[model samples]
Target chain A: MARWQPHASERLVAAALDLFEERGYENTTVIDIAERAGLTKSTFFRHFPDKREVLFGGDTLAGRLADGIADAPAAAGPLEAVAHALEALGRETFTAERREFSARRGAVIAANPELREREALKGLGLTAAMAEALERRGVPDPASRVAAQLGALVMTLAYERWSDPAGHDDFGEAVRQALAEVKAAG
Target chain B: MARWQPHASERLVAAALDLFEERGYENTTVIDIAERAGLTKSTFFRHFPDKREVLFGGDTLAGRLADGIADAPAAAGPLEAVAHALEALGRETFTAERREFSARRGAVIAANPELREREALKGLGLTAAMAEALERRGVPDPASRVAAQLGALVMTLAYERWSDPAGHDDFGEAVRQALAEVKAAG
Candidate 1:
């Protein structure tokens, strides 16, 4: 049996995170990350636009979340819609094997205020995407609005729990639990 | 009866919004806003740390919102506490007299992705403040988390309705409607 070699994008992301943690996000450069990953700088750029993107490069997750909600059954309510979106994306994006890198990436972002702010912006974008998807399904104004924002919030809260080393967490279950908590409180 | 001049800060905010809207946020300089406001650059600097702050430099609103939640009567539920926060700030932050300026400020923020990002970060900060206040009042982990996030979400939804020029929105009423909508969905 042979061990698996990480994908190029994953290799770059991991290398970037380790560099950011050790030398700081600002001090680390693209070339350094590429060298550390045993790949060329061109290979790095082919995946991420910049050193920072190595951490949060794509609209990949955000797009999936939006598409998930839109692709859900027409009859799903706002909360149910959001839960479905999370579940749909969980199979690939939040798999157990990715947990350690995700946590590391999160820690790197947390340590840098600029990255934290960028993360918040990405969070806002996802919420807006959810709102648009739900509105298209004919969920009413404020309900769609509240659900979208809550959906983003659930991601934040759930991701934290899911990535915690002490916990064996499921992304879809965390999302469902978070939505239930809000529904119960509301 | 004698009419009073608007406060220096108000003039600066108004001037900055006018400039940012007309010339774009990046194109407008601090001196340009100061001149438009009929104030000196020194006076503008005394009020706001930077030109961008003109639209977002108010700790007054955030403080009142947090204080309201923290000061809510001990027996109040989470939703009640949020309603109290909005009502408490409504007297000043969302007053009819300030509506025009606030709306203008919102438009300026919405037009610029960077400002929008900063606003999202501020929104996260407010949510954190709400959660801390709720926990102090003895709300538990997931409950407090959901409530705090909902508190922020309600603000985002209500503020949009409140700022629309066509609507005669009341802050407390908007909050109640938003919370009711969520509870109904839940």
Candidate 2:
């Protein structure tokens, strides 16, 4: 047996999600996930603090979003800056290959209260990251907050559309459509 | 040792908040909270599922906001209906007398990560409630979601101001001011 496995983290996440779907999140355990991944319990612990954390991916997404917002064109408005960030996310994180996995992950999260709470907290963290990044760009108080809130909504709506099995649009295009819908509603 | 006590739920909540502030949320147990409230542990359990829920007040606020939205005048727009609901909340839930308690509760929740996660989840629930109510009023899909998202932001902004020790505006006034700020930012 190998002392170290490449893509260990990804394997554990896939194993956890599979077990969570097959036997429900409440019924799945760390040992079960580790067994499914053909890894020891210690190895699973090395990747994620717990089963819940396996799906969350830590603060990586938040950091990428903040950096994306910070790196937007200087002339862009707040929402345009957010749009730019979402476009970057499409090119980097939310690529077409990940759509099926995201759809599965979304379903697992929606079915469990514990995962839903974690997801909600993660959503707030992303919004805060965007808000702070906007403030660093010299956008003022409530406007920055308002734009961040709308931007988070845009991401959420876009992710939903992009992850749906029947949908064909890329993440960036979905974000554009969702942003237009939000603006029109406002 | 009277088995039946008046306002047992309120007393338990206040005691839990006090203990949470003094000893921190993780250090405070249900028994300690019940003892502080001069109630039996079973009575505390009867009132709340756990110590964390003592401050949440269950779904009463969601129910009230939904009812308030539903009761708005037929001529009201989606955001106007949300405003009407918030005004009713000022009169009914976030009354002047509860401001001090709310401030303390907010501080305690802000200090603890578990409490913060729960608060974030509760905020999402409130947003979902508002969105469903708007949908019932024949508001369309993304528009209903957008108005509810903005409405939740208005509630959050207004609650912060209303709970500030130095702020004198009532909840309704703060809601109006927040709505205006959001509109201007939008």
DockQ of each: 0.45, 0.80
> Mind giving the per-residue lDDT tens digits that candidate 1 earns over A23-116?
9999998999989998888887778787666778688887898789988888788878888989876676898888887788888889998788
Residue-level lDDT tens digits of model 2 in B1-186: 677889999899988988888889999999999999988999988888987899898999899989999999999999989999999999998999999999999999999988887898889999999999999999998888888988999999999999999885599999999999999988
Tens digits of per-residue lDDT, candidate 1, B31-69, equal: 999899887888888888987767777666667777899
Fnat (0 to 1) per candidate: 0.60, 0.83
Candidate 2 segments whose C-alpha is farther than 4 A from its true place: A1-3
Candidate 2 structure quality by residue, lDDT tens digits, A122-146: 8999999999999999999888888
- Any runs in candidate 1 off by more than 4 Å, and if so which? A1-7, A40-42, B1-6
Interface RMSD of each: 2.4, 1.0
Which candidate has the top score in TM-score? 2
